[model samples]
Target: MSWSMSLTSFPSRIQTHPTIHLLRPIKPTISSPPKFPNLPTIRSVQGNFDHSPITPAKTRWETMLETAASLYPLYVTAGAVVACLKPSTFAWFVKRGPASYSLSLGFIMLAMGLTLELRDLLNLFVQRPFSILFGCAAQYTIMPAFGAIISKSLGLSPALSVGLILLGCCPGGTASNVVTLIARGDVPLSIVMTVCTTLGAVFLTPLLTKILAGTYVPVDAVKLSISTLQVVVAPILLGSYLQRTFPAAVKFVLPSAPLFAVLASSLLACSVFSENVVRFKSSIIGASLASDLSPVLCAKAILSGELGVIILSVFLLHFAGFFVGYLSAAIGGFREPQRRAISIEVGMQNSSLGVVLATSHFTSPMVAVPPAMSAVIMNIMGSSLGFFWRFINPSDSKDSPKVDDK
Candidate 1:
């Protein structure tokens, strides 16, 4: 009997054959099983597997939402932790408050400027100019009006009322674009609106505040405009020019914007607290007492209790701005994305600016409460809204109607 063996390089295996008994080397024969008698003979199946179809890509809005969803928790947590630690660092922060607030404002303006492009400005002449314009109008008009109404209705003190109006009059926050993007809104449009409103605010904010807040509290439009232009417009223009001219420079500035903003805000918070401590020390000490406390302590306790009111009013106004801004956009023929953008843009005022203005001009720490508290509340509320939108939307994983931009 002959036996043969073959080695296959493809599978790296040795094949043995028992049919051949002689010592002859040859290729082995492999065959399919024979069909049973009367059974149908099967041939083969052929198709193109390499060129199979795949799911479509997600839209820009969908991508934005996913990104926002991922980062929102960190933003909220950071803001909360910072705020909780304020009391301990109060004195240090207050001493450098104005400078810190100014730095933050400058950084935010610079970031805004860097983000802007010529094409974005050209978008003003495109199909949805009215949408942008109306959105801006709604933001400036409705928000301040609501603030004024709320302040009056609540019978808040003059300082609180003016603070609310000041907050309302300020431009949309930097965070607005982020929230708008997450909500699947037109991010470019949001950015443009923010830039326009912010620039316009260099002049308009002072004018509007003087007109609206003057009735409630003393205001100096000229001084306010100068301050705003110095802190907001100048930095923004410089940053935008740098971004346009040297794109790489933005890398350094972008990360620094938030850091500066945080630092500035912390300083502003400290300044306000310190001023409050100094001016209303008696009242605060009095209010701090639990009740049936001594007169010396009673003063501190009263001031401390007033802080609670200040915090509450700030929260109320911030939330109200957010809710009203979103609802107004939705009612005004805006879709989900645009509405989200509008809501955020309207809701989150530039509270850092408000703080700076209040502290520099008002001389009363109480006046700064609305803006400082607003800064904290807006971040929390904006983050919450972003998270909620993401929770419901969940990127492009779920089926949604395709947006028709025509």
Candidate 2:
């Protein structure tokens, strides 16, 4: 009652006397802060992301393709050059007689000669001698048999028949070593087998040819032996010696050897082609005879219409060699790599050598046909087979036993 009355009185008084006092303002102070109930705590940052690199495994097919692609241009160029070379350019070389041919042959032999030391041979012996031996035996046995049978059945001219047999009698090629490496086979073993067979063939090739081809051609064993010694053995010995005595020179030579070999082979091919061009032309013309034609026409037919049959047989023989080599190694308890080496060594033949001999000695284009065809066919077939083995038998390649190079 007093407060209300006082306010009213104050209002009346203020109205009456228009003067009043003002009150001062006071500040308030805070006591404590509130906290969040469920907030998460912060952690340290992660280190920089990893940036390590990775590598992929290489494959046999990749190797084969790479090597083949690299070599194919050289092969084509060599073939083209040989085919186009003026006959007159080579005529002088040929007319200069057997001596020039012998010299060229000698060069080939020297080029082929491997610079394998005693240690390499010892390594081969300790690692896989049996596998090597079996491969060699299978190569010699099956190939010559196949060749003889095919040649006889085809009723080819005697010179041609003998030529086929000689082709069979020859050793596995140095090229096989390269192919084996591409296939991821045992390269060292392949080299050993190639070298061994080549060296052995110095004597065995002539003996085998004389025995098998005596009826078909005048295989003068004595003269042939001398020719082989002059053309093959002497040069090989010289080359091997040079490689051993002059290692630096060999380093330079080795890189160019394949190219030189190709050139020499192309020249040899040209020489053969020029001489046999007429015969090959005639054979092509003659091959068109129908199966039911007269005997006279059949006889006139080059390779006796048996060319097809012989080709088929040779294809079979090649496959057989591959199989035999592989199986033999497997049976002998060899590891995967050695088996692969054996298979390759058994399958590939030195057809170039055969072509050279056929051209030099037989002088028949028909005789040269088998080796010429073989040179082309084997590469195609071998490469295809290698692809299959790599794709289908990959585990066999990697997990199978290995021969220690050491």
TM-score for all models, in order of appearance: 0.70, 0.68
lDDT of each residue in 110-200, candidate 2, tens digit only: 7766344535565545655566676778777867877777778766678667877887888886667666655666666677777777777
Off by over 4 Å in 1: 1-93, 124-127, 251-263, 270-304, 394-406
The best candidate in terms of lDDT: 1
| Residue 65 accuracy (lDDT) in model 1 | 46
Write model 1 residue lDDT over 120-197, tens digit each, in one string: 465442645766786789778877887787788778889888888888899887777667655655565577677778
TM-score of 1: 0.70
Clashes in model 2: which pairs? none
Q: In model 2, which runs have C-alpha deviations exceeding 4 angstroms? A: 1-101, 283-317, 363-365, 390-394, 397-406
